[model samples]
Target chain A: MQLLIGTQAVELDKEGFLKQLTDWNEEVAIKIAQQEHIQLTAAHWEIIELLRKFYQLYELSPSMRALVKHTEQTLGAEKGRSVYLLQLFPPSPAKLACKIAGLPKPLNCI
Target chain B: MTTNNKSITCKKLLFISRHAPYGTSLAKEALDAILAASAYDQNLSLLFMDDGVFQLLSAQDPSDLEQKNFAAMLPVLALYEIENIYVHFESLQARQITINELILDGVQVIDSKTICSLLTQQDQLLSF
Candidate 1:
Protein backbone atom coordinates (compact mmCIF):
# COMPACT_ATOMS: atom_id res chain seq x y z
CA MET A 1 0.00 0.00 0.00
CA GLN A 2 1.02 3.59 -0.51
CA LEU A 3 0.49 6.59 1.73
CA LEU A 4 0.38 10.02 0.18
CA ILE A 5 2.10 12.51 2.39
CA GLY A 6 2.17 16.08 1.02
CA THR A 7 2.01 14.71 -2.51
CA GLN A 8 4.86 12.28 -1.81
CA ALA A 9 3.88 8.63 -2.10
CA VAL A 10 5.32 6.45 0.65
CA GLU A 11 5.24 2.69 0.39
CA LEU A 12 4.00 0.34 3.09
CA ASP A 13 3.88 -3.41 3.38
CA LYS A 14 0.67 -5.40 3.16
CA GLU A 15 0.65 -5.43 6.96
CA GLY A 16 1.00 -1.61 7.00
CA PHE A 17 4.54 -1.31 8.32
CA LEU A 18 6.83 1.15 6.54
CA LYS A 19 8.49 -0.37 3.48
CA GLN A 20 11.33 2.13 3.53
CA LEU A 21 12.71 3.14 6.88
CA THR A 22 13.92 6.45 5.49
CA ASP A 23 10.47 7.38 4.24
CA TRP A 24 9.27 8.29 7.72
CA ASN A 25 9.06 11.80 9.13
CA GLU A 26 6.64 14.02 11.02
CA GLU A 27 4.67 14.53 7.86
CA VAL A 28 4.46 10.80 7.25
CA ALA A 29 3.58 10.27 10.86
CA ILE A 30 0.70 12.65 10.52
CA LYS A 31 -0.46 10.86 7.39
CA ILE A 32 -0.24 7.49 9.06
CA ALA A 33 -2.11 8.72 12.11
CA GLN A 34 -4.74 10.19 9.87
CA GLN A 35 -5.11 6.86 8.12
CA GLU A 36 -5.63 5.30 11.51
CA HIS A 37 -8.20 8.02 12.26
CA ILE A 38 -6.14 9.46 15.08
CA GLN A 39 -5.54 13.18 15.19
CA LEU A 40 -2.03 13.70 16.45
CA THR A 41 -1.93 15.25 19.87
CA ALA A 42 0.98 16.68 21.81
CA ALA A 43 0.80 13.64 24.07
CA HIS A 44 0.96 11.31 21.08
CA TRP A 45 3.98 13.10 19.66
CA GLU A 46 5.73 12.80 23.01
CA ILE A 47 5.37 9.01 22.96
CA ILE A 48 6.29 8.84 19.28
CA GLU A 49 9.56 10.68 19.83
CA LEU A 50 10.30 8.51 22.83
CA LEU A 51 9.67 5.38 20.80
CA ARG A 52 11.97 6.57 18.01
CA LYS A 53 14.69 7.39 20.49
CA PHE A 54 14.27 3.97 22.06
CA TYR A 55 14.58 2.24 18.67
CA GLN A 56 17.73 4.24 17.91
CA LEU A 57 19.35 3.11 21.13
CA TYR A 58 18.12 -0.45 21.39
CA GLU A 59 17.82 -1.17 17.65
CA LEU A 60 14.42 -2.70 18.35
CA SER A 61 10.95 -1.44 19.10
CA PRO A 62 9.91 -1.85 22.70
CA SER A 63 7.47 -4.57 23.52
CA MET A 64 4.31 -3.63 25.39
CA ARG A 65 5.89 -4.44 28.73
CA ALA A 66 9.14 -2.73 27.81
CA LEU A 67 7.26 0.29 26.53
CA VAL A 68 5.33 0.60 29.76
CA LYS A 69 8.45 0.17 31.86
CA HIS A 70 10.42 2.70 29.82
CA THR A 71 7.58 5.15 29.88
CA GLU A 72 7.35 4.87 33.64
CA GLN A 73 11.09 5.35 34.07
CA THR A 74 11.42 8.18 31.58
CA LEU A 75 8.01 9.79 31.49
CA GLY A 76 7.00 8.94 35.08
CA ALA A 77 4.95 6.30 36.79
CA GLU A 78 1.66 8.06 36.09
CA LYS A 79 2.25 7.79 32.35
CA GLY A 80 3.81 4.31 32.28
CA ARG A 81 0.72 2.25 32.84
CA SER A 82 -0.83 0.38 29.90
CA VAL A 83 -4.10 2.18 30.62
CA TYR A 84 -2.51 5.56 30.00
CA LEU A 85 -0.85 4.47 26.77
CA LEU A 86 -3.98 2.73 25.64
CA GLN A 87 -5.99 5.85 26.17
CA LEU A 88 -3.53 7.76 24.00
CA PHE A 89 -2.96 5.13 21.30
CA PRO A 90 -6.13 3.16 21.82
CA PRO A 91 -5.64 -0.63 21.83
CA SER A 92 -2.11 -1.50 20.74
CA PRO A 93 0.33 1.15 21.87
CA ALA A 94 3.57 -0.65 21.06
CA LYS A 95 2.55 -1.54 17.53
CA LEU A 96 0.84 1.77 16.75
CA ALA A 97 3.59 3.81 18.34
CA CYS A 98 6.22 2.05 16.26
CA LYS A 99 4.16 2.53 13.13
CA ILE A 100 3.82 6.26 13.73
CA ALA A 101 7.46 6.51 14.74
CA GLY A 102 8.33 5.12 11.31
CA LEU A 103 10.04 2.11 12.75
CA PRO A 104 9.75 -1.48 11.62
CA LYS A 105 7.04 -3.68 13.04
CA PRO A 106 8.07 -4.52 16.59
CA LEU A 107 9.48 -8.03 16.91
CA ASN A 108 6.84 -10.55 18.00
CA CYS A 109 3.94 -8.24 17.11
CA ILE A 110 2.44 -10.57 14.55
CA MET B 1 1.90 -3.68 13.28
CA THR B 2 -1.48 -3.09 11.65
CA THR B 3 -2.59 0.28 10.32
CA ASN B 4 -5.80 1.37 8.64
CA ASN B 5 -8.27 4.24 8.57
CA LYS B 6 -10.25 2.39 11.20
CA SER B 7 -9.40 3.27 14.77
CA ILE B 8 -7.10 0.85 16.57
CA THR B 9 -8.67 -1.87 18.72
CA CYS B 10 -7.33 -4.57 21.02
CA LYS B 11 -7.59 -8.07 19.67
CA LYS B 12 -8.11 -10.91 22.12
CA LEU B 13 -5.81 -13.47 20.55
CA LEU B 14 -5.71 -17.01 21.92
CA PHE B 15 -2.97 -19.51 21.17
CA ILE B 16 -3.62 -23.21 21.82
CA SER B 17 -0.76 -25.66 22.16
CA ARG B 18 -1.59 -29.35 22.09
CA HIS B 19 1.80 -30.90 21.40
CA ALA B 20 4.46 -32.22 23.72
CA PRO B 21 7.89 -30.65 23.67
CA TYR B 22 11.10 -32.29 22.33
CA GLY B 23 9.38 -34.69 20.00
CA THR B 24 9.45 -31.76 17.59
CA SER B 25 9.92 -28.01 17.65
CA LEU B 26 6.19 -27.24 17.64
CA ALA B 27 6.00 -26.55 21.37
CA LYS B 28 8.86 -24.07 21.40
CA GLU B 29 7.73 -22.47 18.17
CA ALA B 30 4.26 -21.92 19.59
CA LEU B 31 5.66 -20.37 22.74
CA ASP B 32 7.95 -18.15 20.69
CA ALA B 33 5.04 -16.97 18.60
CA ILE B 34 2.98 -16.22 21.71
CA LEU B 35 5.83 -14.26 23.27
CA ALA B 36 6.20 -12.26 20.10
CA ALA B 37 2.49 -11.57 20.05
CA SER B 38 2.67 -10.38 23.63
CA ALA B 39 4.77 -7.47 22.40
CA TYR B 40 2.07 -6.45 19.97
CA ASP B 41 -0.09 -5.09 22.81
CA GLN B 42 -2.94 -7.46 22.24
CA ASN B 43 -4.85 -9.37 24.93
CA LEU B 44 -3.20 -12.77 24.65
CA SER B 45 -4.15 -16.05 26.32
CA LEU B 46 -2.22 -19.30 26.01
CA LEU B 47 -3.91 -22.68 26.49
CA PHE B 48 -2.20 -26.05 26.80
CA MET B 49 -4.20 -29.22 26.26
CA ASP B 50 -4.01 -32.93 25.41
CA ASP B 51 -0.37 -34.00 25.27
CA GLY B 52 0.60 -30.37 25.49
CA VAL B 53 0.00 -30.37 29.25
CA PHE B 54 3.15 -32.47 29.66
CA GLN B 55 5.16 -29.39 28.76
CA LEU B 56 4.53 -27.89 32.17
CA LEU B 57 6.15 -30.75 34.08
CA SER B 58 8.64 -29.51 36.64
CA ALA B 59 12.27 -30.63 36.99
CA GLN B 60 12.46 -31.38 33.28
CA ASP B 61 15.87 -32.77 32.42
CA PRO B 62 16.77 -32.68 28.74
CA SER B 63 20.39 -33.78 29.24
CA ASP B 64 19.68 -37.31 28.12
CA LEU B 65 17.94 -36.09 24.96
CA GLU B 66 20.61 -33.47 24.12
CA GLN B 67 17.94 -30.84 23.42
CA LYS B 68 17.59 -27.29 24.60
CA ASN B 69 15.28 -27.05 27.61
CA PHE B 70 12.36 -25.25 25.99
CA ALA B 71 10.22 -25.64 29.11
CA ALA B 72 12.33 -22.95 30.75
CA MET B 73 10.59 -20.42 28.58
CA LEU B 74 7.34 -20.98 30.44
CA PRO B 75 8.44 -19.01 33.46
CA VAL B 76 9.66 -16.14 31.31
CA LEU B 77 6.26 -15.64 29.73
CA ALA B 78 5.16 -13.64 32.74
CA LEU B 79 8.00 -11.19 32.18
CA TYR B 80 6.59 -10.57 28.72
CA GLU B 81 3.25 -9.75 30.44
CA ILE B 82 1.66 -12.93 29.18
CA GLU B 83 -0.05 -13.73 32.47
CA ASN B 84 -3.11 -15.47 31.12
CA ILE B 85 -1.74 -18.97 30.78
CA TYR B 86 -4.31 -21.77 31.02
CA VAL B 87 -4.19 -25.55 31.00
CA HIS B 88 -7.08 -27.86 30.29
CA PHE B 89 -8.16 -29.52 33.53
CA GLU B 90 -9.28 -32.73 31.88
CA SER B 91 -6.08 -33.02 29.90
CA LEU B 92 -4.04 -32.92 33.07
CA GLN B 93 -6.17 -35.50 34.83
CA ALA B 94 -5.98 -37.80 31.84
CA ARG B 95 -2.20 -37.47 31.78
CA GLN B 96 -1.96 -37.98 35.58
CA ILE B 97 -0.36 -34.58 36.01
CA THR B 98 -1.07 -32.41 39.02
CA ILE B 99 -0.99 -28.62 39.27
CA ASN B 100 1.75 -28.75 41.90
CA GLU B 101 3.97 -30.73 39.54
CA LEU B 102 3.92 -27.90 36.98
CA ILE B 103 7.07 -25.82 36.90
CA LEU B 104 5.44 -22.49 36.16
CA ASP B 105 3.32 -20.30 38.43
CA GLY B 106 0.10 -18.37 37.88
CA VAL B 107 -1.30 -20.90 35.41
CA GLN B 108 -5.08 -21.32 35.60
CA VAL B 109 -6.51 -24.79 35.27
CA ILE B 110 -9.66 -24.38 33.17
CA ASP B 111 -12.47 -26.73 32.44
CA SER B 112 -14.07 -27.20 29.01
CA LYS B 113 -16.86 -24.75 29.78
CA THR B 114 -14.46 -21.95 30.49
CA ILE B 115 -12.40 -22.88 27.46
CA CYS B 116 -15.45 -22.80 25.21
CA SER B 117 -16.51 -19.43 26.57
CA LEU B 118 -13.00 -18.14 26.02
CA LEU B 119 -13.00 -19.45 22.49
CA THR B 120 -16.25 -17.67 21.78
CA GLN B 121 -14.86 -14.41 23.11
CA GLN B 122 -11.60 -14.39 21.18
CA ASP B 123 -11.24 -12.46 17.94
CA GLN B 124 -8.53 -14.80 16.73
CA LEU B 125 -7.43 -18.32 17.66
CA LEU B 126 -4.22 -20.07 16.72
CA SER B 127 -3.62 -23.75 17.52
CA PHE B 128 -0.23 -25.41 17.38
Candidate 2:
Protein backbone atom coordinates (compact mmCIF):
# COMPACT_ATOMS: atom_id res chain seq x y z
CA MET A 1 0.00 0.00 0.00
CA GLN A 2 1.01 3.63 -0.52
CA LEU A 3 0.07 6.93 1.01
CA LEU A 4 0.28 10.19 -0.88
CA ILE A 5 1.90 12.61 1.50
CA GLY A 6 1.92 16.01 -0.23
CA THR A 7 2.23 14.64 -3.74
CA GLN A 8 4.95 12.15 -2.65
CA ALA A 9 3.98 8.50 -2.56
CA VAL A 10 5.04 6.85 0.69
CA GLU A 11 5.23 3.07 0.60
CA LEU A 12 3.70 0.81 3.19
CA ASP A 13 3.52 -2.88 3.82
CA LYS A 14 0.54 -4.98 2.89
CA GLU A 15 -0.80 -4.69 6.41
CA GLY A 16 -0.46 -0.90 6.27
CA PHE A 17 2.69 -0.80 8.42
CA LEU A 18 5.33 1.71 7.47
CA LYS A 19 7.73 0.50 4.79
CA GLN A 20 10.55 2.75 5.96
CA LEU A 21 11.04 4.29 9.38
CA THR A 22 12.81 7.39 8.09
CA ASP A 23 9.91 8.17 5.82
CA TRP A 24 7.75 9.05 8.82
CA ASN A 25 6.94 12.57 9.85
CA GLU A 26 4.05 14.39 11.48
CA GLU A 27 2.46 14.71 8.08
CA VAL A 28 2.83 11.02 7.45
CA ALA A 29 1.36 10.27 10.81
CA ILE A 30 -1.65 12.45 10.07
CA LYS A 31 -2.09 10.66 6.77
CA ILE A 32 -1.87 7.27 8.36
CA ALA A 33 -4.30 8.26 11.10
CA GLN A 34 -6.63 9.55 8.51
CA GLN A 35 -6.51 6.26 6.68
CA GLU A 36 -7.41 4.52 9.91
CA HIS A 37 -10.38 6.92 10.31
CA ILE A 38 -8.90 8.37 13.45
CA GLN A 39 -8.66 12.06 14.03
CA LEU A 40 -5.37 13.13 15.58
CA THR A 41 -5.88 14.52 19.05
CA ALA A 42 -3.56 15.62 21.82
CA ALA A 43 -4.30 12.31 23.49
CA HIS A 44 -3.35 10.33 20.38
CA TRP A 45 -0.23 12.42 19.88
CA GLU A 46 0.74 11.64 23.46
CA ILE A 47 0.91 7.91 22.70
CA ILE A 48 2.66 8.54 19.38
CA GLU A 49 5.38 10.60 21.04
CA LEU A 50 5.85 7.96 23.71
CA LEU A 51 6.20 5.23 21.08
CA ARG A 52 8.79 7.32 19.22
CA LYS A 53 10.78 7.85 22.41
CA PHE A 54 10.70 4.11 23.14
CA TYR A 55 12.06 3.38 19.65
CA GLN A 56 14.79 5.98 20.08
CA LEU A 57 15.87 4.73 23.48
CA TYR A 58 15.66 1.00 22.89
CA GLU A 59 16.22 0.96 19.12
CA LEU A 60 13.17 -1.27 18.97
CA SER A 61 9.49 -0.75 18.70
CA PRO A 62 7.55 -1.62 21.81
CA SER A 63 5.11 -4.51 21.92
CA MET A 64 1.51 -3.91 22.95
CA ARG A 65 2.25 -4.85 26.52
CA ALA A 66 5.31 -2.61 26.59
CA LEU A 67 3.27 0.17 25.07
CA VAL A 68 0.77 -0.07 27.91
CA LYS A 69 3.56 -0.09 30.48
CA HIS A 70 5.24 2.89 28.87
CA THR A 71 1.92 4.66 28.88
CA GLU A 72 1.37 3.94 32.52
CA GLN A 73 4.88 5.13 33.32
CA THR A 74 4.80 8.30 31.24
CA LEU A 75 1.13 9.06 31.15
CA GLY A 76 -1.21 7.90 33.87
CA ALA A 77 -2.86 4.56 34.60
CA GLU A 78 -6.19 5.72 33.21
CA LYS A 79 -4.69 6.24 29.76
CA GLY A 80 -2.51 3.19 30.04
CA ARG A 81 -5.31 0.70 30.25
CA SER A 82 -5.90 -1.40 27.14
CA VAL A 83 -9.56 -0.48 27.07
CA TYR A 84 -8.72 3.22 27.09
CA LEU A 85 -6.13 2.80 24.36
CA LEU A 86 -8.54 0.77 22.29
CA GLN A 87 -10.97 3.64 22.52
CA LEU A 88 -8.35 6.03 21.18
CA PHE A 89 -6.94 3.74 18.48
CA PRO A 90 -9.50 1.16 17.69
CA PRO A 91 -8.47 -2.40 16.74
CA SER A 92 -4.73 -2.47 17.70
CA PRO A 93 -3.21 0.50 19.47
CA ALA A 94 0.45 -0.51 19.30
CA LYS A 95 0.41 -1.40 15.63
CA LEU A 96 -1.47 1.73 14.58
CA ALA A 97 0.62 3.89 16.87
CA CYS A 98 3.90 2.52 15.50
CA LYS A 99 2.77 2.95 11.94
CA ILE A 100 2.03 6.59 12.69
CA ALA A 101 5.28 6.98 14.60
CA GLY A 102 7.19 5.70 11.55
CA LEU A 103 8.43 2.54 13.22
CA PRO A 104 8.31 -1.04 12.03
CA LYS A 105 5.42 -3.31 12.99
CA PRO A 106 5.85 -5.07 16.31
CA LEU A 107 7.09 -8.56 15.31
CA ASN A 108 4.57 -10.29 17.57
CA CYS A 109 1.64 -8.25 16.25
CA ILE A 110 0.19 -11.19 14.33
CA MET B 1 6.81 -35.46 18.49
CA THR B 2 3.74 -36.85 16.77
CA THR B 3 0.31 -35.32 17.27
CA ASN B 4 -1.75 -38.07 18.84
CA ASN B 5 -3.92 -35.47 20.56
CA LYS B 6 -6.65 -33.59 18.80
CA SER B 7 -6.27 -30.01 17.58
CA ILE B 8 -6.13 -27.54 20.42
CA THR B 9 -6.20 -23.77 20.64
CA CYS B 10 -2.97 -22.01 21.58
CA LYS B 11 -2.92 -20.69 25.10
CA LYS B 12 0.41 -20.99 26.86
CA LEU B 13 3.46 -19.80 24.90
CA LEU B 14 6.96 -20.21 26.30
CA PHE B 15 10.08 -18.29 25.38
CA ILE B 16 13.35 -20.04 26.24
CA SER B 17 16.54 -18.03 26.36
CA ARG B 18 19.91 -19.82 26.45
CA HIS B 19 22.28 -17.35 24.80
CA ALA B 20 24.63 -14.92 26.46
CA PRO B 21 23.21 -11.44 26.41
CA TYR B 22 25.18 -8.59 24.70
CA GLY B 23 27.52 -10.84 22.71
CA THR B 24 24.77 -11.19 20.12
CA SER B 25 21.38 -9.62 19.38
CA LEU B 26 19.57 -12.90 19.97
CA ALA B 27 18.61 -11.93 23.50
CA LYS B 28 17.02 -8.67 22.44
CA GLU B 29 15.28 -10.27 19.49
CA ALA B 30 13.84 -12.90 21.75
CA LEU B 31 12.63 -10.20 24.11
CA ASP B 32 10.89 -8.38 21.28
CA ALA B 33 8.97 -11.52 20.43
CA ILE B 34 8.09 -12.13 24.05
CA LEU B 35 6.87 -8.59 24.49
CA ALA B 36 4.83 -8.87 21.33
CA ALA B 37 3.26 -12.07 22.52
CA SER B 38 2.42 -10.49 25.84
CA ALA B 39 0.63 -7.67 24.03
CA TYR B 40 -1.71 -10.17 22.46
CA ASP B 41 -2.74 -11.15 25.99
CA GLN B 42 -1.47 -14.68 25.41
CA ASN B 43 -0.30 -16.88 28.25
CA LEU B 44 3.42 -16.09 28.19
CA SER B 45 6.27 -17.58 30.23
CA LEU B 46 10.01 -17.02 29.95
CA LEU B 47 12.78 -19.46 30.88
CA PHE B 48 16.34 -18.21 31.23
CA MET B 49 18.83 -21.05 31.47
CA ASP B 50 22.42 -21.75 30.50
CA ASP B 51 24.32 -18.59 29.48
CA GLY B 52 20.95 -16.85 29.55
CA VAL B 53 21.42 -16.47 33.30
CA PHE B 54 24.05 -13.86 32.53
CA GLN B 55 21.28 -11.65 31.21
CA LEU B 56 19.87 -11.18 34.71
CA LEU B 57 23.17 -10.25 36.31
CA SER B 58 23.42 -6.73 37.69
CA ALA B 59 26.00 -4.04 36.83
CA GLN B 60 26.07 -4.75 33.11
CA ASP B 61 27.74 -1.83 31.35
CA PRO B 62 28.12 -2.36 27.62
CA SER B 63 29.50 1.09 26.89
CA ASP B 64 32.98 -0.25 26.27
CA LEU B 65 31.56 -2.76 23.84
CA GLU B 66 29.41 -0.10 22.15
CA GLN B 67 26.21 -2.05 22.83
CA LYS B 68 23.03 -0.82 24.37
CA ASN B 69 22.31 -2.26 27.81
CA PHE B 70 19.50 -4.46 26.59
CA ALA B 71 19.27 -6.21 29.91
CA ALA B 72 17.86 -2.97 31.26
CA MET B 73 14.56 -3.97 29.69
CA LEU B 74 14.17 -6.99 31.98
CA PRO B 75 12.57 -4.96 34.75
CA VAL B 76 9.94 -3.76 32.33
CA LEU B 77 8.68 -7.31 31.85
CA ALA B 78 6.20 -6.89 34.64
CA LEU B 79 4.55 -4.08 32.73
CA TYR B 80 3.73 -6.57 30.01
CA GLU B 81 2.22 -8.92 32.60
CA ILE B 82 5.11 -11.37 32.08
CA GLU B 83 5.57 -12.30 35.69
CA ASN B 84 6.32 -15.97 35.06
CA ILE B 85 10.04 -15.55 34.43
CA TYR B 86 11.94 -18.71 35.42
CA VAL B 87 15.67 -19.28 35.69
CA HIS B 88 17.36 -22.66 35.95
CA PHE B 89 18.76 -22.93 39.47
CA GLU B 90 21.51 -25.30 38.40
CA SER B 91 22.46 -22.98 35.60
CA LEU B 92 22.97 -20.14 38.02
CA GLN B 93 25.01 -22.30 40.39
CA ALA B 94 27.14 -23.49 37.51
CA ARG B 95 27.85 -19.87 36.63
CA GLN B 96 28.75 -19.13 40.27
CA ILE B 97 25.92 -16.59 40.53
CA THR B 98 23.09 -16.44 43.00
CA ILE B 99 19.56 -15.10 42.85
CA ASN B 100 20.54 -12.17 45.06
CA GLU B 101 23.04 -11.08 42.42
CA LEU B 102 20.32 -10.66 39.82
CA ILE B 103 19.28 -7.18 38.75
CA LEU B 104 15.55 -7.66 39.28
CA ASP B 105 13.42 -9.55 41.73
CA GLY B 106 10.48 -12.03 41.43
CA VAL B 107 12.19 -14.45 39.04
CA GLN B 108 11.41 -18.06 40.00
CA VAL B 109 14.21 -20.60 40.27
CA ILE B 110 13.23 -23.95 38.82
CA ASP B 111 14.91 -27.28 38.19
CA SER B 112 15.02 -29.28 34.97
CA LYS B 113 12.15 -31.45 36.23
CA THR B 114 9.92 -28.39 36.44
CA ILE B 115 11.14 -27.27 33.04
CA CYS B 116 9.91 -30.55 31.55
CA SER B 117 6.54 -30.15 33.21
CA LEU B 118 6.24 -26.55 32.01
CA LEU B 119 7.04 -27.65 28.45
CA THR B 120 4.15 -30.09 28.52
CA GLN B 121 1.73 -27.26 29.35
CA GLN B 122 2.81 -25.00 26.53
CA ASP B 123 1.17 -25.00 23.12
CA GLN B 124 4.29 -23.44 21.59
CA LEU B 125 7.89 -22.79 22.61
CA LEU B 126 10.34 -20.27 21.18
CA SER B 127 14.03 -20.70 21.95
CA PHE B 128 16.98 -18.39 21.45
Q: Give per-residue CA lDDT, model 2, range A47-107, as digits (tens).
A: 8898888877666677777788789888888888889888888898878888888888877
Q: What's candidate 2's DockQ score?
A: 0.38
Local accuracy by lDDT, each model: 0.84, 0.84
Give the candidate number with the greatest DockQ.
Answer: 2
For all candidates in order, state the fraction of native interface contacts they contain: 0.28, 0.44
Compute the lDDT for candidate 1. Answer: 0.84
Pairs clashing in candidate 2? none
lDDT (10s digit) by residue, model 1, range A50-90? 98887655456667787888798789999999999998887
Candidate 1 DockQ, CA atoms: 0.13
Interface RMSD of 2: 2.7
CA lDDT, candidate 2, residue B123: 82
lDDT of 1 by residue, B2-121 (tens): 555332567889999999999988888888788788756789999999989989998777869966565555765765788899999999999889999997779999999999998988
DockQ of each: 0.13, 0.38
Q: Number of clashes in every candidate structure?
A: 1, 0
